[model samples]
Target: MGKLSNCLSMIQILMARPKVKIDDLAAELGVKPRMIRVYRDELEKAGIYIESVRGVNGGYSLDRRSILPIRNFNSTEVQELQIAIKSYLSKQPDHDSTLDNALEKIKAAQRDQALSSKHFYFANDYLINAEVGNESEHYKRLYHAFNHRKKVMITYEAASTNAVTKRTIHPYAFVVYDENIYCVAYCEQKEALRTFKIIRIHDVVLVDQSFYLPENFDIRKQFPHLGFIREPQEVELIIDTPFSNQVKESIYSTDQIIEELPDNAIRFKATLNGEQSIKKWILGMGTKARVIAPEHLKKEIQLEVEQMLQNFQK
Candidate 1:
């Protein structure tokens, strides 16, 4: 394996099983114990804290508080991180040689501090297939506008009718759920908050106008209850066993209530803003879940499933 790869593997191993002896590391790396010391020194130079305990119970372990969070990444996450880093680097202009040089140094430091075998155990299978076109450009512009608290003028193609219309919006933030990116913005034309899919934006232009974010505007708090476009609404769902745990853990955080039923089923209740997102989530669970309360929502989900079945038959 390459030096950088080896280093990353070593770091992962140490993080997973701290207090591992030098001899064991050498055995795992297929090198002499002396060489393990060299790798340890390299890690220390790169700002990793490798505490060595001596005597009969002597071994090396990471000082958990001092070690960076990257040490905990699974192999897939590491590969994704590498791709993101490369993508960012590739976007830098050709004239930015100094920045490129600095990036190389940073990469080297990261490689030296990481566990070498971490990259060897598994093949990276997660591929991020982001569509690169006008939609991608719109996403970038929207992200910038949201970050800078600026308004944006966009030509959006409505999903329901596919009609194109121009509108001005105060871009608030973005939510990347499932495989799509959504922009949460205050639409001046609609006089209400709206969520626009980045894919449906035909054109986007950052406007000079800026807007003030409300003091009560907490993205996480509002997102779960009201979603990007919808007003907050109370919704209850009945989930069957095995799937109940998955549903509860995935959808509701610690704040939400989860009640266990005698039938080994689980009931989840939450005040969500956008029913659409949660509805889609329940449908994804298949027959394992059913919406009990709010007669309208239950009917909506049933209708959606029937429509899906019809589309499939075609």
Candidate 2:
């Protein structure tokens, strides 16, 4: 890449991340650590101030405001760009607040050129911009643990029960589902892998302990439903018409099997994690959906209905 393009790329990287090491820049730019020093000097000359830290955990960063150059995109590139932006924003580090501005800029570009606006941004319905801190310091620390494969201690508030607890975890991966961010980690207390919503996480601190991830620890293979559970359980549901008939085809998990029943309903079966999530989905559907097998889930739903009815009567 040309020097000017390289400099801009470096600036963008620094802006997106809290800090980056010279080694990282070198690898990305196909250069040497010494070349990073030269680029830093060049950036300084261009009125871009990059703060450098020296030590074992040292790197460079900048907080100055800089406008990204806009480019015209072809039809295919526009679609790809929208997808790229949505993907990035959906899984951005918790400390990343500039994503909103970046998305706004993309929207502006689309509006200026009269491009289609639909699907340019993640649908708000699917995502909760549920940030725990305004400055996102927790996200930053969590990222540190993830990047270095370190153990981290965290205080987490449960989304279902609102119960709060503390645990130490070996940070593994960050998964994005329906535009929401979740951290998948091995919880020391649970002795298993669990997914924690980013919004429910707080007080994340590196435990000064390192960990080696398992050899087959692929995030996608390990987490099909955003890391909610490490294991998948068989789930069978009966969808009543006209919702069942309205569903044109299988749209949920790729492994889901949908069969048209003789009674004009649909039978849906899939191995999934997160019983609570499925329960909530079923409850949301009201009378339109019912659990078939797994008698325990049916009873759980029955009790939930009873409780709701009792509450309404009160």
Model 2, TM vs. native = 0.43
RMSD, one per candidate, in order:
13.4, 14.6
Winner by lDDT: 2
Q: List, residue by residue over 1-314, the lDDT tens digit for candidate 1.
A: 76667677788998899589989988998888898788888887866778899988989898664476544553333433443443343333232345445544444444432332211111111111245222366766876676577999999999889999999998765554433456777899999888787788898988998887664564554455434344555678788876675544443333467898867788888765445556756776679888877788899999999999999999
Model 1 residue runs over 4 Å out of place are 1-173, 177-180, 183-197, 203-229, 251-255, 309-314
Clashes of each: 17, 0
Off by over 4 Å in 2: 1-171, 176-182, 185-200, 205-217, 222-232, 245-251, 262-264
lDDT of each: 0.64, 0.65
Colliding residue pairs in candidate 2 = none
The digit string of per-residue lDDT tens for model 2 on 204-276 reads 8789889887756666566544434454567788998765754333244557788888778888887665555
